[model samples]
Target chain A: MTTASAEKTAENGAGEEGYNFAYLDEQTKRMIRRCILKAVAVPGYQVPFGGREMPLPYGWGTGGMQVTASIIGHDDTLKVIDQGADDTTNAVNIRRFFARTAAVDTTEVTAEASIVQTRHRVPEDPMTEGQILVYQVPQPEPLRKLEPREIECRKMHAYKEYGLMQVSLYEDIARFGEIATSYSYPVMVNDRYLMSPTPIPKFDNPKMHDFPALQLFGAGREKRIYAIPPFTKVKSLDFDDHPFEVQQWEENCALCGAEDTFLDEVILDDRGGKMYVCSDSHYCARRRAEGHRGTLSDSAAAAYAAAVGAADRPSEDGESAEWVT
Target chain B: MAAMATLAGSAPGGIDTTDLKPGLADPVHDSQRVFRALLEAMARPGRPLQLEEGLDPPFPLDPATAAAVLTLCDHDTPLWIDWIADTPPVRAYFSFHCGCPLVERSQQAAFGLVSDAENMPRLGLFAQGLDKYPDRSATLVLQVPSLSEGLAVQLSGPGIDGRETLRAAGLPDWFWNDWRLNAAQFPLGVDIIMTSGRALVGLPRSIAAEG
Candidate 1:
């Protein structure tokens, strides 16, 4: 058998033989679990942890992977999303990695997933209770860029001194006539710690507030983990007069004609060609399956057939592990 | 050779008759499930979840408490226990399953167990942690009578939506006031996990409640 064939995972069989369950040792998982419990206890407060080296690099969702590995059980259904697209290489690779290592069933449907590990964007679908959302955070501190010192940041957090973050927002409003931060927007968690919502676009910030699902953030490189419990208040920083506003697009999705979801601008070609599509590819596919179509799509019937077809779950036939969506 | 050939699963007079009977049936998967339940309980403060089932602990020990101890505790964690949980059987169970050091003083403990809620120590007695490292505080596994029925208190804070009703029974009258003082400490207080037979509710420092 070829190396590639040996690597292919068809179902929830025993994963790679050498590695422990979920690729993390029992001791490491315990330590990370301790950090996780602490993170959940103090909502949005970055709890320092002893970071471990992963198979992948630091920034490429290692932190989120660590959290997912620690919390994932045998019965869990895993989902991985990079920028909300399930078909992306990073998303597919991570999904494959977990499928092979942990021997857990993986899916692309946002609602069906028990643990959704994501980078850059939250799923467009509403996350209900019992669903755990793990975010890949580059930096856990919201005040890091302003105050580089760790001790000062901890002191500020201890004393409830969040004026520096507010001042920075004020500076943005003064220059751009609004809070200019498009992604990784600063949010006050439970009206306490100012938290970085993991580089997700500002449009997804409101979804964090009063969300029914537990949200966990992990910064592997920074050796920190934080969390926002379900039903918690996560408010984006803005003035009363200015108010916090999400980015709005006049263009609909180029593939599924979604007018409400966060749109991603796609470059069609070199000759000044571009089209706006839903950043959440899973939601876009669902829309297409429900008969929504755009100018780029072939037809509504074709889109439906392409979406809710045999390709959506290819592992049932025992062939390719590439994500269809 | 005589001591070595004694027995496999239990001591001469161990509470747990079998070694495997002390902890979860399956450590890897069971810990995951228990922790998931615990994560949910922590995320939603007022709501009580059926944490674990079918656990036979020593006298006065709740199954939910045993489940948490088995899943979360290790040699690194120092656990402080009250008289109810300080019995010989209970100590043997912890030694066999958890192996966590049982500390006499609450302040030195990273975790605490209070089977006697009425006589539980003051919230300040447990480690409140340092100002800079508030997460270093202790997490008390407080065994209560019933999480479903009790004094209907209002809980509003980080984890709560607008306002939530928590009905915890058998708690002292000074429970709410003591919790209030604890909350006033803000990033420096011990978190509580109230447990009954098979149910538990997490009361993290982020919550503020009044009866």
Candidate 2:
């Protein structure tokens, strides 16, 4: 049989012979594929699905992984990040899994990747039309607080019954001087459906509007998936009296000296030594390559390399087998 | 429309357990099918849903709806039972089947299941949705002994263009009164589904309770 026919045969069956490509069955992929098309058509609308269990836990990046697995093909280049760092433990593990199963090419640069699975931050590079950003969402509902029932939420979406959401925001203005939401601020997608940008800082909210890339939000535990297609209109919810604003810290990324990037506060030692760093690891790495270095990067990288090198080293007998835990 | 393709045969008509997706074990697959049917019934208010099989549930709740609770609830989901009205067998079965913990009060439950609506707690007891995003609300599953045609309540809302009435037997008079107040909490109040041994009817928060 030709290679193409063999590949097609494997695609029709789950884990047939030697393939478990991404560990999801083709039927499940077909289901997710259907959901994606509907999401793209409705743009910014949430569609409920029978989300399956992965080998990984729910809180971890399972949702994003599922989305990646569904859309990832032989030709795709994948990139995964946690807290914006590609080398972070969770990110490393996910990338390694994809490499083993799907044998897809991996990239560290944002612009080079066709599919990027991310948590917490959007990349500094403006995404082009061909790229897809899959977000790991813990909570997918924008109106979960008002109507706990999935049945009710469906009705609200059908009729555009959203008065209760308005009341909650008005209350926020009443209590705080402004809308107190910083991270995970709710936004209206395409002026038709309300969506959560998956806990990305409000700084990323504006970037969501009319973006060139397709954005997919998956909340596995919540059993919901939502999307924002290329050039879709997204507006953060706010009143005329108090407009929406992104959260800004007084300090810049100490390493990059960049004020526009979202900063992650790193506490050094017990003395409460505070330093701000760019949350996006690629952005931070680029800054360092340009001769910008934070106080902690050198120490952190040295410790990390030593630990990994030791873990990878061969034993005295030259046998590569790792000891049982 | 593509998303609805796989779900078409299973939606309005109750799912056949034998025809379920391969590799799914009993209870999980059956419950999933029933839950989807229930969700569809609730999505379209005043519509009655069919049960493919009898549930033979422990006590207080029927087998069909029990299957729904088992499929939907988990450790992450919060469940509220009628005040001291639900039986021990029912509670134990839910804990075993769904792994869901009991809520101390009605307001806290993601799902509120009531066996008796006559002496039911106030509708205000359930959590209401906030103003900014009103979708966060509780789902109430009320178990009535029988379903009939007389003295039913009319439902008209997002899914229903004209008035539609559903007969749910064995409910208290004050139930509608409490539901009236619950409807006022639209985006904030609870969504209710009244179930008998074989039939189901939904009352979304969007519906206005007739006086």
Candidate 3:
């Protein structure tokens, strides 16, 4: 139904050239908006929506893009990030798409953006009130892996029967001596529903609890949208003895020297050479700008700085240098 | 002059057609703003939101309801209104601006508009959707006397930090009883948007309402 209308609107020249404003018709936006309302009303409850197919593929942040397109306005400054980096290929493409379709301003700075669309990681920077965070979810249902059938999953949610999930955690502990799940960790929102916080590492899970910004999760492939309102309760699922824990490293970011941020282990060569750097590009840049230095060598630091500068500058054809590479 | 004469000639009970002119001035921006307010109201249940744009519908329709219908109702949404708000002018106004189809049965309605909260239909009358697709349930937009300074109801649920007290005037005593039952239904009950003057308070089905 959406594709037919999109084609019709494209032929009619409703929006910029062929595409509609933000690439969705007003009716689709209304439908998604109603779904969003219900999702927010029942926090962590996944609401089924008529998820529309974007120009991009489903797994590549299509759901988050749809949510952002629906709520974003001309005045909103949009920030798109992949694995907490603004210069990643997926993030750059999404940012450019919205910038062209909606004609909205785009920014890399977390504090300046009114809407932040992310995949895999939430920014280390705390979001203030009125700012919205849209998460691109591949799987909205946390129990889908355990129970593949949708009917059974719905019944389980209705009955609050989370024994399967608990059993899975127990099995993981029995095998690995600890909870094996790392990213996409399940959380109980408002102490009612068990929700999947996407693929964001378990390290970023604590940031979700009592968050000031409204967090929206959209899964295009799963055809679901869920929400965590501002200051809402979010607890990561765990047993009493096996409490939830985040990944920790002995070294700080190679460029920023930040001890708190989630670090990514980058392999410089095929040999045993590896360095720990901040997964959040913006956080790392801000720290570097503040004159923070790590144990990185002078040549390696200079190369990193050059790469960051090149990524920030848009080429003459309006594409970021990161895209070409 | 001709259009005005024709409109007046077709008027029911000699009611002035000129006075029944209240709709969104700017459809795009105005609807967006109203939707944002509604989103906030739903996310934070039992919290009162002062709608920035004041709408002037006929006598019975309040500003908040007017804004809600304008923003939410469209061609896709099937709206059902009570007899009090099912007047010709109100119907015509919504039809012209929103293009929403009016449904005869309340159960078929995706969105419902109620002018009289005290004598409104039972909660079970509207669509509760199915268990698999609970979001298919109806959203009720009810008009009350006042949003504040009335009977205090304790609300605790997904949105509330702990517990919050809400006072809404001109509601029947049985409303709380019905709300408790509705909340028990979990993902299968209708959500409510209460409008009084230019303020709105959302009471989603997830909220546990106690007197």
Candidate 4:
């Protein structure tokens, strides 16, 4: 074939053979970058842009991936997590995707990553300066639940008319004796606009306040991006009498004995046997490596140990290789 | 061939275009650095950020403004240049390098360049963007004499913890009055970037500016 035909064929087969650097063209990146700058300029204000459809589905972290792609360089280390576990299927898929497309290093450790894309949880570890946390948002507007009309929500945000949100919270209190918003709790950004902190549980809401790392939220389906610069104030919406509170658990992690971390309840069988473990897999594993034993029975601990050992094995393709325990 | 050579040889006013300078040497990396600096400047309003200096645009264009224009503007962005910078050579340079169309009306521009801040178009002249998407508003990049040697103005808003004092010269006395009117609109106002030498300070619409 001639050189021209070969180039045409390559262009035709771009997706299967090779993707653009980080899977986004430079023009698209520039557009998103402009939106990001504006979002940073006006904290908690959602800046709309032309959100591109990624190779993955819309609900599957396409937003976070795009933000990561725009900001990531060849030298950056990326980490992806779903519900705070690095070994989940979605996290592994995203990690593998970036590994192939961008050729950047991937890590499971929270502190080692320069960029962390998360779906529903912020890592328990404190992020240092220069690190960026990208959250995949399903809904960018905090008032969407109350007002379905986009125009009305815009006006409400414009005139600082947040009475509907307060009424909703008051109604929740009247019904359940507490604010019923467990995840995706609304928070005020820089004391200006009310923002939804994605779907992270209320337990992680405190981490968004005065955070050292810059936080960027992208909603691909909604075609919006917003930001909270480092050290910006974020206050969860609440009344003085009914202050904000996180979920409290009576049991520590069954595997790592970490009482401070967010815990996930796991059922052993059809019987009444149950256990609580850290939702963050890396945090649990690091504690286990540090020889922090928990309340797991002997056989359960041994079985968990074997599973972790298998997960640490080296593989031929490094993309699917076991995550660091 | 003669016509083509003439078109390329010199712009209007007999300014030779043979030795035209380059924009950021490495477009991708350099633009990323510039964007980072711009992001910081916008996030922390009233704080001066020193930008990397390499661009060599013609006279009347400050280094910071030029760097910002080159980094942010593309064919997609419509640019509006003030009277002082609406020259043929500068227009040719922008059209050739950035590919952004020069607009006559400030309201239509995605980015506006002001060479003379004292005579700049009124804040109401530019697009304040729609209420739904206020980010669509134009970002005004004003070239000033110096950032540190101006009248001290107090700014208080989202980025500022309490209030910040900044010295920005080269603006009309009525600018602060206009800014107050602009801030009253909240989510709907033109954001300003003051450039002097290689430094820039952002004044986002959320800020309350008072002398």
Candidate 5:
């Protein structure tokens, strides 16, 4: 759909010549490319850039979209996921957005994609050197909580100051007995620039350090873009007594019976009935296809089918899945 | 991550200013260029930089300097302010234009506006990068009261060939002494910018103060 329109725009001989390959205009792409180059040069350094407004909202993966849009060309394959599910509405919409704008090929398999825009979790599969991961950061400043002022933070960055961050962590331990921030925690990138991993779980934080893929962050409403180039080091802010830890689940996935994947706990009934499922849809599906089965696969499938049936049944306003479980 | 679908919905490179938010309508492009100039100024210290046109704010901050912050800061980057000039209009302008969060404490800011040099906090209170890596220093955007002929001080440091004197205004002697100590930290000191309307001067982390 996007290909047709892009071709139409091209055929119409839009604006000046030497514009960018897609519609990003050469200067914009050049600026983004320059930032990417700097990010690559200084791995894990959050090189700030002038972020532009996309035809989308702020929180909904605009950063990843911008990075992807800047890097993508007609030949590249794109993959987008949200909560590890490609079929999820946001993922589908983002995929559609890129398809329409850049006119690039879209894929679901992680390995095949040249660029992947992700929210929450990194893929279970290992990322390669060629790929780039663009994260959607809600907040980019790590010292934001410790120091609220941009002027102060800039002074901090300029002066190489970070004592307050340590003080805040110590206070957190003194009060809560643990660092209260569960996800989207601050990690020092390349031991220099402070970066926000965009609310991805702690499980994904380790994956960020020493990763082969180039990592980029964009916060549209905030108008900031930072990056972690390939091979950069990333470390979660922690102390000797308080080591960084991923979320641990006592039970295996109810769908794929996998113990390693992140699990989503579901309450089956008011009487403490419960089930757990692998949050990575692709991984879960692959496991099920490979003869892996869990205690509730059959029942869950039935329940899902019943829910779909109920939705398909026309109601007063023709709404479907309005109240999803 | 998924690749973009196609090239259909991509808007033109530049949006119409009339269509843009009032704060953002006219300045995105020029703001970007000027911000780049500021970055370049820091990347190589002591270099005088020129700003693009179309930026003018009220007293306290020079237009070019204000333009630099407007380009980089948003509601996300908090400002540590030393003094308040037209509070309502300034706040409204920043919120509407840049959407930058304002911070009262100097230590917590990403950028700071030091209106009064006499009342400026100790430089050590701001961020200095950690031991292993030290480029984490802060960037100070100082608005000096005046920049006149022969009102200068000598500078010496990494970026300078030798002793170089440049004119500046409204900074205390303690500020320079502290800056020298800050520069002794090498890759861990703050960068400074002193500006009037169209003209501006920079002192990157590399510059050391000389008597």
Candidate 6:
């Protein structure tokens, strides 16, 4: 995923052949910047901004792109990931979009990237102080599901009234004997605003607390921007008896042979065979290159590589040509 | 530079506007850099970032504050300049470069600049925003003497890791006392950005300051 960074800033006029640098006009960037400041000023508090339409659709990391476009500079190294894999279509297209539009350096190695735009997963790597992590949020409001009314929700946030949210959590505990929420876990930022963690698994919630990197969340369709500045307290909302716990797996990552990382279960065949591989593709690859091998890694490595490669290029003839003939 | 329209007597309140200066050399990339600095400063409250934009904005505005004003403010944001900063040249400079409406009252401003921090208006005078809409408050940009040479205070809050010290001189005797009252408002208070020379430190509403 780490493409050899080429020097192309001078040739592209800060963007591709025609578009403005980073694809956003100066004024729009200014507007977004000001909102970002406000969001930082009040951590975890969502600040509404006049969100602009991006070339991509609303759900496909458009909010993250807008935030990236606003803050990205010529010298910054950009990296995009969908569910922690840089090779996925959403990640690939977005990385290419910035490479062409923003004319910024691109990398896949988490440490090398200055501004990382992510969806569904925060990188396993610990980001440094100056690095920025931009999250694409589908819903900026944490209480929207409970209250539904925007005005009522606003009032609740104003007064720090979160009894409804706590009641919903209690209901989850009563039904499942434990809190059943696996993702999009609610958190109390700075012990003030209850914020939605944007569907990132509860496993990543602890990483946000006192993390050195600045975390920014943008919800394009919702027209809201929020932030969690570096070193802020992000506590998972939970009772003492029913403590917040992240999902744990009995199996380690089959690809990386690691006991800690999150694993994605892949069905091997129709005969009930399954393999648990690292959800973070780059991390798994790095581990494999360091001579770490799982139970089936030696046998399945070529097949997995071929499958990912096949997904990269479409059938050139047509969809019918692959199956019809 | 955009066409310098020196509207001598056309400025509000009958201020001469002939002497003006350019905002930024490169509006697009320059502002992005400036905004990143501003964002970083806001995130790490006591930390100062180097913001030498090579700008010479009118009599009152320094490079850091000017960079912030030029990058953040627009026609949509109503701006206010305190008496010390509300000079004819300052008015002319903002009018030509920023085009932000300069409101007479501090409460009406989304952004404010205070040249004389020691004698500036009280914290309550500016927009404290609303309960529902806290981000609608005013962001005051002040030119202080130095970030390290002044009254040192311990800051611990959202942005600070544990405890960071903030030092700046020339603020009024009532500054910290007023700040405490302002912080009592929680999500409904003004944010301050102090600039000295080419450096700046952001004092957002969330920071808890102690001497």
lDDT tens digits, residues B134-193, model 5? 434455777776655535678754333445677676777687789789867655656666
lDDT-best of 4 and 5:
4
State model 2's lDDT: 0.67
- Winner by DockQ between candidate 4 and candidate 1: 1
lDDT value for model 3: 0.84
Q: Could you tell me how far off, in angstroms, the CA of residue B53 lies in candidate 4 after the best superposition?
A: 5.5
DockQ, each predicted model: 0.66, 0.02, 0.51, 0.42, 0.03, 0.86
Q: How large is the interface RMSD of candidate 5?
A: 10.4
Model 2, range A2-118, lDDT digits (tens) per residue? 012112233432223464566676556545644553354344567666698987899787888888877775566777778776656677667666665666666667888888999
lDDT of 6 at B14: 48
Candidate 2's DockQ = 0.02
Q: What is residue A152's positional error in candidate 5, in angstroms? A: 1.0
Candidate with the greatest TM-score versus the true structure: 6
Q: Looking at model 1, give its docking quality level.
A: medium
Once superposed on the true structure, which residue ranges of model 2 sit more than 4 Å away at CA?
A1-17, A293-325, B1-211
lDDT for model 6: 0.84
How does model 5 score by TM-score?
Answer: 0.56
Residue A36 C-alpha lDDT in model 3: 96
In order, the Cα lDDT scores of the candidates are: 0.82, 0.67, 0.84, 0.82, 0.63, 0.84
Which parts of model 6 have CA positions greater than 4 angstroms off?
Answer: A1-13, A310-325, B1-17
Of models 1 and 5, which has the larger DockQ? 1
Candidate 1: which stretches are off by over 4 Å? A1-14, A297-325, B1-21
Deviation from native of the Cα of residue A156 in model 4, angstroms: 2.9
Q: Is candidate 2 or candidate 5 better by DockQ?
A: 5
Give the Å error, residue B105, model 1: 1.0
Candidate 4: residue A254 lDDT (0-100): 90
